[model samples]
Target: MDVNFSKQGDWTIIAVEGRMDTVSAPEFEKMVQERILQGSNRLIVDFSKLDYISSAGLRSILVAGKNSKAKGGELACCGLQGVVKKVFDVSGFHKLLPIFDSKEDVLNRE
Candidate 1:
């Protein structure tokens, strides 16, 4: 997947394209860690272009989310559709993670 990152105030927004599977999970994890290291606590992941995600991808995000929470920060996701949404649904990650219908929704809420 191709990942693009931007910032808004204290929040870091990431746009991910393509598939986030075993091959790309580590790369994404590295990006996330870099953002955290930059002192960005609030995170919003845009999955509008993401086509697929595997267990490894899910695990990496879960770990990142936990770290963000432990740091008293927040991590939100938006724009997931089709198979990507289904993956999170089946894994019960829809409930575990804070997901939004759109980027505006996440930005406006909390």
Candidate 2:
């Protein structure tokens, strides 16, 4: 998986590409933790280019979400589609976290 960071207003955008599986989940988790610890509380995880996600990937999202909440900020997700969206819906993550159809959708809501 490849992760890229950017900013939009008060939100930190994390754009992930490729597959987020056990092998790559840890790296993704670490990146998120570092960002949160560095004071990036408002987060948007963009999964548009991600083709697959395993349970480990889900765990990373859970951790990031919790960490953000603990810091009095929120974590949202965007660009969920195909298997990734299915996994999230089946795992009940669709209800646990805020999800947008696209990055522009999230931004428009703000």
Candidate 3:
């Protein structure tokens, strides 16, 4: 998987591409952790190009979300589709995580 990071205002936007499996999940987690340690609390995960995600990926996301929330910020995801959306829905993550239909929706929200 490929992870690209950018910043918009107080948000650290992470754009993920390809598959997020066991091997890649740790890398993803590491990147997020680094950002958090750098004092980046508000996060937006853009899964617009993500094709697949395993349970490990979900775990990583959960950890990142928790860390952000614990720091008095928030984490949100956008642009979910197909199998990825199905996984999230089936796993009940859609309810637990803040999900938006588009990046614009996330960016515009309070």
Model 1 clash pairs are none
User: What is candidate 2's lDDT per residue for 1-110, written digit by digit as tens?
Assistant: 88999999989999999999999999999999999999999999999999999999999999999999999999999999999999999999999999998888877895
Clashes of each: 0, 0, 0
Model 1: lDDT to the true structure: 0.89
List where candidate 3 sits over 4 angstroms from the true fold: none
Lowest summed lDDT across 10 adjacent residues in model 3 is found at 101-110
Off by over 4 Å in 1: none
Which one wins by lDDT: 1 or 3? 3
RMSD of each: 0.9, 0.7, 0.7
Tens-digit per-residue lDDT, 25-46, candidate 3 = 9999999989998899999999
Candidate 3: Cα lDDT at 43: 94
RMSD of candidate 2 to the truth, in angstroms, is: 0.7
Query: In candidate 3, which residue pairs get closer than 3 Å at backbone N, Cα or C atoms, i.e. clash?
Result: none
Deviation (Å) of 62 in candidate 1: 0.5
The reply for model 2, stretches above 4 Å from the true place, is none
Put the candidates in lDDT order, highest first. Answer: 2, 3, 1
